[model samples]
Target: MALSLKLRQGLVSFFLLLLLLPSSFVAIEQAFYTQLLTNAEQKLEVHLYAILSELSMREDKIELTNNALAPDFYRPDSGISAYINDEQRLLWQSDSSLNQQFELPNVELIPGQHLFHLVSQQQNFWVLSIALLFDAGEQTFPLTIHIVQAEQMLLLPHQSFKRTLLQWFIGIGIGLLALSLLAYYWTTAPLTRLDQEIRKLEQGKQEQLNLSYPSELKVIKEDLNLLLANQNRQKQRYRNHLSDLAHALKTPIAVLNTSALSQQPELKEQLDRITAMIEHQLKRASSSGQDIWKKELPVRPLLDKLTGALHKIYRDKACPISIDCPEHIQFRGDETDLMEILGNLLDNACKACQHQVKLTVTDKPFCLIVEDDGPGIAEHKRQQLFNRGTRLDTYKEGHGVGLSIVAELVSSYSATITISDSPLGGARFTLQFPLEQ
Candidate 1:
């Protein structure tokens, strides 16, 4: 199954934590081990000086004041031991070294220096040694002190510390991951609701979008609601138009049925008219102008191709049709709807013009105005320009049908259409559309 956004984000956050935290903990453990080793060396160095203080110089040989030493040095199997050696004899060894054969790696050191090394016998061991020069009036003496302890004596406590730290880190990592998942789901709860509502819409369980959403999703909700409203409006318009078209065709069919001899041409004319009406209504019904998710279509090229076709149709008039549109400007609607609207408007303007037809497109307010230099319509007649299938210019065939379709297209896109007198001394039609974002 596909993962939802919330689950995907949570998994990513958890994996990142898992990857980074272990390396961080391992670094911290290494630092702690270094500090622990330093402390262990200091403890062993103290025992070396204790052995030095108890030594006595004699002409015959070097001697310790007594056999008694630190407790661990005497305790059997304590893992701690000391040794004292003269130039030519095995002078002494700690009681703790009773069953071992380990020795210091270095025999001598500089007068003021002590040295530490690791050696192996029964186990890995730490051996610390020092050389001190004693002077009498007539002779000199050299003695070496050695302290040896098993490495495990120092490492055992560090191992326990590591186990404790690992436990704590694992616990913290799991806790943090849980908290992250909780927050992720909480923050995305509204999105889940929105998704459910959309599915409900697709299944026709709901008439419209009605869920209350957070601000982050509020704009999207509003847009979806607008889309649903537009779809319903288009359906209603199609139903009303179909009913009216049927009523209209009934009269023409009745006229043809009643007429008989020497009325064949009249009957043929009525049939052609009925056919035209049916074709027009079918074309309008099929155009899906309620597409709210449509992308912007570039307007310049559509206008360009349209004006070219009109020029050919009205070639005898040779009307100078000028276009003032930006090459990169776009219209936010279905491309076919725009073509229908613009095509009808421009063709009407071309029909009415005597000498000039001009199209001006503006970006700031996102509108296009088409004006022609012909006899303009009076102001009173302009008010009824968009009524369904009502021809104010009865002299021109199909005038009402084109303008009604343009009005419907405009309504579907939340646009406005207005008629006014033009500066060119003719009628002007302006289509103002919503701004592109």
Candidate 2:
């Protein structure tokens, strides 16, 4: 459900491209169209001046003294036309306009004034018009010169530029995408390597982070290695203290056992209880519970060894222990913790079953199920079965502390143990371990 850093970066880049590329393309296209209009207006203004210079007055009417203008004025349908008007009357028109039906712009202008804009009719055109005063025998005449060019002329160049611009932008977008992908990989390479190293450490393939890393990650690497060293030292010291305590208590206990008071029935029982409590506490303390890092060990080999030993110990019953563990199934904790859990569960199943016992290992939830074919535990009594001194059977073999130890060990690893009715007609002890992933 959570997104990785690389994927987040890639998504940001993708959305930026989606927003920026089209905006850039539109901005560039609009700018190019404006430039085309400016160029078109300038060209029309030049033709207007050329036509104004060639005009003359004849019989008090405007006329062209000479056809000295751009060749577009002389060529028909050339998309460029010129006209001269006097007070709403057409004085003269260009040869190019003879076959075209373009109406001149109706605009009021004074002498020395000019106007340039676009006009829409059946088709669009750019118009440039200027007003001028003509002199003839002391009479002044106001005349307007008009020059118009079809919008198609500018559109041809505009569309061509758009196609060219689109191609360039598309190429640019693709190149940028490729570079972003390469940058994503380049930036995350160190993180990928560090992740692999951590996984190897978890699997007990490596003891500490040994790979060379960037400055940002080097501090973390050093801190982790130091923590591992400190934990090792602390565990060693704790074990040494427990060993010393055990040895110190051993002498007093031996002397008591040799005394006459310890031989009394009640005193002997009390002494035996004290000895069992000591053994239980020491075993519980020795467990490497819920360590930060854990090793992965295959379950099949250990299961074979436990089942073999249980068979020899309970040879009188000769109850079959059916193991349903895959060869690759693994336990992700201390080997001693796994052995203690499975050993106690299997041994109890063998003792409780009349004929059959079963042990199954599963990976999905990382659970161990031990079942037997004997009288099932009562629901009311099951809740108290794990108490330190609660024994359900009269077999006189165990101190009734195994399940309690199992509960403490399971709780340390953040695991759960449940007792339920088994299909085999006896109690099912289900030990589910926490999955690392």
Which clashing pairs does model 1 show?
A: none
> Model 2: per-residue lDDT, tens digit, 201-313?
76778878899888987898899899878877877898899999999999999999999999899999888888889988997997887576676777899999999999999
Compute the lDDT for candidate 2: 0.86
Q: Per-residue CA lDDT of candidate 1, range 393-436, in tens?
A: 64546636678788877877778899999999999999887774
Worst 10 residues of 1 by lDDT: 286-295
RMSD of each: 14.4, 4.8
User: Which has the greatest lDDT?
Assistant: 2
Residue 151 displacement in candidate 2 (angstroms):
5.0
What is the clash tally of candidate 1? 0
How many residue pairs clash in each candidate at the backbone level? Answer: 0, 0
Local distance difference test, candidate 1: 0.78
CA lDDT of each candidate?
A: 0.78, 0.86
Off by over 4 Å in 1: 1-4, 59-62, 84-91, 101-103, 106-109, 116-122, 141-144, 230-437
